[model samples]
Target: MSFTSDQAVEALRAAGEPTRLRVLTLLAGDELSVMELSRILDQSQPRVSRHLKLMADAGLIERFPDGARVFYRLSSDLAARRLVDMVLDLLEDGAADQDHVRLEEVRREREAEAAAYFEQVAPRWDQMRSLYVCESAVEAAIERAAGPGPFDRVVDLGTGSGRMLTLLGKKARLCIGLDLSQNMLNIARSNTAKAGLDKVELRHGDIFATRLPGQSADLVIVHQVLHYLIDPAAAVREAARLVAPGGRLLIVDFAPHALEQLREEHQHRRLGFSDAEIAGWLREAGLATSAPIALPPDTEDLTVTIWTATRAETAKRSVA
Candidate 1:
């Protein structure tokens, strides 16, 4: 997998520009669309897109298509990542201050939007969970699908009410729950404290770019989170990056359905996901996936689907 002289030169040339370097630094934080990049850079869409396309071609970044929109992030390739790291290290102090400031502004705007949504829904979040299926049944299925564990570390991405941590944290030496909503994190904190789970830590975080080290968790859970994301597959890829060798990723979400009302009423970006879609994402993320288990609803409710995948015992790679 060594890069040839020509490939190395091409990569350097691709990353040599100031704008492209700024783009790399921005993408180092989170995946962003062309529009977002343009806004942050105060550049035209076509200009931003050309930079992205060149970097992608040079393997300096990765592009993921979500419907009509495409998101870009730092390349997952090891050599490309190393090159990015070297470039970042060479940046002058305060060189990226402006970009960082604008990034924070964008983040605040996103936080405000999410806070408003969660404020409206926080009181009824758990109640809505009940409307889908029997809580006990779903919890049991999650436990069985996640399997028995004496894991070293566990992380729950988009932990809404801290239910998964309260249920599964006991088996792990340490458990961390991440959420973007301050209200949700507050509820999670209160719930975890009530459950007497002192090892559980809740943090306000972006799921696509958590502070945790790559391949650091023995068990990673993303319960009922995918439907809300603009790019669920990219989120899955992020979660997979956290799985240590021999670690497992357990995802609990709704099976494919035609719940159009959920989009308008609940801010659901997608109705549900098919098994094939979930499996394809897992496989693409370099995990060995199991056949998805479906828990049918008793009435006219959404069917819950559980998928579990394990990182290879000997595999060790970082995801960007």
Candidate 2:
């Protein structure tokens, strides 16, 4: 048999059991000692050890000696990690019952606190560029769709840091940014001005119900914003509605996952969308769409997915 087949059989056999899968999810984000795993799963140390040993042998987790004790974590194998992430994504949000709800609440509180801290220090946003990786692949996708041009109008939804607009400044004759927070908008305005791009305008708006003109923009870019919305499908529909004939809509966000803890803590609207979900949203919005191109591995914890949609030629006449 081929190595691929052999590996597949082994992986399936190893992950087929519920206990091992649980072990993987527990160790997805951080490491845990055997005792910690036992506590989290409410299982005996011997049972947890048995599961961990199987996963480690299957190359799903690694061991580290800490004095006389050992810690276990999700393995370094990218493929194995990807498998664990996919499986976890399939699990339901309430899988952990009340514990899940409480954890999500705590996560939301922490994220709000962090967002508030960023808001208070909004003036220092420009200096915080080093803290994040500039999503180059998304930038490349937007440039490909919109091209270098003196676009008459442009809309950047969820324009965090106003980075997408700044990236489009070379071509957008008039760029408008819509976001929820006054503080984020303030930072966006300052950043645009500092870049000497006076044609850009910032507004406090929700992507779901913004009053912006429909079918006006030559390019609509929503980068790193959909995952945070409560109704990503609605947000995508709104984004598509903003695209004029011959216009392009660009979306960048995570692929779907079962990580309820991250969703609850981070205020993520959804774990993320898979390629199928992205295609469905674009088609429903009356735009011809493309599959997502995966972002580079080094981007961030969130995977980057790009979908480029162009208004159908007949779409011009179908408008109300």
Candidate 3:
């Protein structure tokens, strides 16, 4: 994606302002709302938004409206992205010490809000998710990633509503679902029972330390769960550990986005995740990952991604 002379000049000119440069620095850390930027910069909303509009117009940044709020991030365009990166690299870290400190404060506030929101909305989790992304499409994609598995054992981490259990239960001889919320587990129990999967087992357990034996399951799934965790990579490693030799791990979550309202209203610690980030974690756990499949929404909502990874069959042969 080579930048034309005009595009390069516009981007450089848009980012030339001191305030706009600061905005880019903050956004380089994470996407931010105009209000957030205003607070961090001690400027009025109208004034801050003017700077954002200029940068966004020049393709130096991107603006997305998530429900009632709008957020901005560095442009996803490769040429514009490269320009921002090179320019950011030249800016001294010390120039924005106070801004970073303020950003941390905003981050903590978001975490607290998400935690409180999670407590309030645990019961209607599935229905809420259905409002965001089409479940049928995501489920079909998940089933495809899972393939035909008369698996010996299957494990589902953060199994809210036991939807995964119900979807995969009939295919497994032993099915286990673990979650930190007993209330959610209860909901899962009722859902799985309604599906006539009486043999399915539900446990109130932590995804980060399931305490389940390593390499115990033929299929391990972490569906729509990673975004809530403070340590998603750790959870991925834990999920990978439970995959048996030659078994598969399927992760379903949203692709990278700038949906700020989801963070404020629905307790999403992350807007979404990138392919390289998730694949890197799987690789670190000694699993081979396939190219991720994305299912973009019909509207301006989130895009769901399915990542499938497998433990090498050679590992089993070697151990034997």
Candidate 4:
């Protein structure tokens, strides 16, 4: 879509400032909180927030509110994203060298923090899984729910330990797993390597905004990751964005339950999702959803629910 003159001018004005430009450069790579941007830019939170607000108002960036935290990223507007790309392309070589250096430091700190948390939980991840339904049953259900596909590309969002990739990698020419924790990625890598899946790729990524292009995958799986997110619906929308035309999105998570202990013990943000909630989010994303398949636990544990949706082949809307 062509931008109006006023819109173009607004977008340009928003991108004209040096600090805002640095914000754009950093956000172009990953989603970041206002605090993180402030730390990276060596500016106060108020100052960073002001720039973010202006850019957001001008449609140059998108703000995602996740509970108490809000993350900022380049807008999904094609025109605005193209504008950002053009502006970034015009930067002098090494002009933001220090910014990049600081960004790396920030990333390392994030990695260390995430690594520590995961390290504490990694040994028990599988043990925790056993508390639910049988593993074989869940895997079979997932395989059947996803349908038979020799998909060209497959992406697993929040791919903890790369279990889904290992389970479904044979059906795809290429499979990629994305995780926020480097420790989890390491485990996933080791597991995928053990499975001898040569086409699998693992990347450190944010669930809110990933580095992959829109509608780039034939099959997208978000397995057992929603309960931990502050905004489960937003995560679903982001997962839907990765589905190609006629592609499928498979989400496996827990149904609503009174699992108060899970939150305190496991760091779960939300207890579980309801059927209506999942369906509503899928409809909002312009995907056709199938009836959810429920796998009730044999023991006294949380019930597992699998929701599948398909992106319409003729839809013109971007999955923003």
Best model number under TM-score: 1
Clashes of each: 0, 3, 0, 0
1-320: candidate 2 lDDT, tens digit per residue: 12266675676678778777766765664455686567667789999888888878877678855334566877656777777777789888756454334434544554466466546656665455323345555567667766667788889987767877788875888999998767889878887887889898898887877788778888898877776553467788899988888888888776654556654454543566778768977997889986567765453455567788888655654333
> What TM-score should be assigned to candidate 3?
0.65
**Which pairs clash (backbone N, Cα, C closer than 3 Å) in model 3?**
none
Model 2 lDDT on a 0 to 1 scale: 0.71
* TM-score for each of the candidates: 0.67, 0.59, 0.65, 0.64
Question: Which portions of model 4 show Cα errors greater than 4 Å?
Answer: 1-116, 317-320
Worst 10 residues of 4 by lDDT: 110-119
Backbone-clash count (model 4): 0
RMSD of 3: 7.0
Query: Between candidates 1 and 2, which one is better according to TM-score?
Result: 1
Residue 66's C-alpha lDDT in candidate 1?
Answer: 43
Residue pairs with backbone overlap in model 1: none
The global Cα lDDT (0 to 1) of model 4 is: 0.84
Who is ahead in TM-score, 2 or 3?
Answer: 3
lDDT scores for all predictions?
0.85, 0.71, 0.85, 0.84
What is the alpha-carbon lDDT of model 1 when measured against the actual structure? 0.85
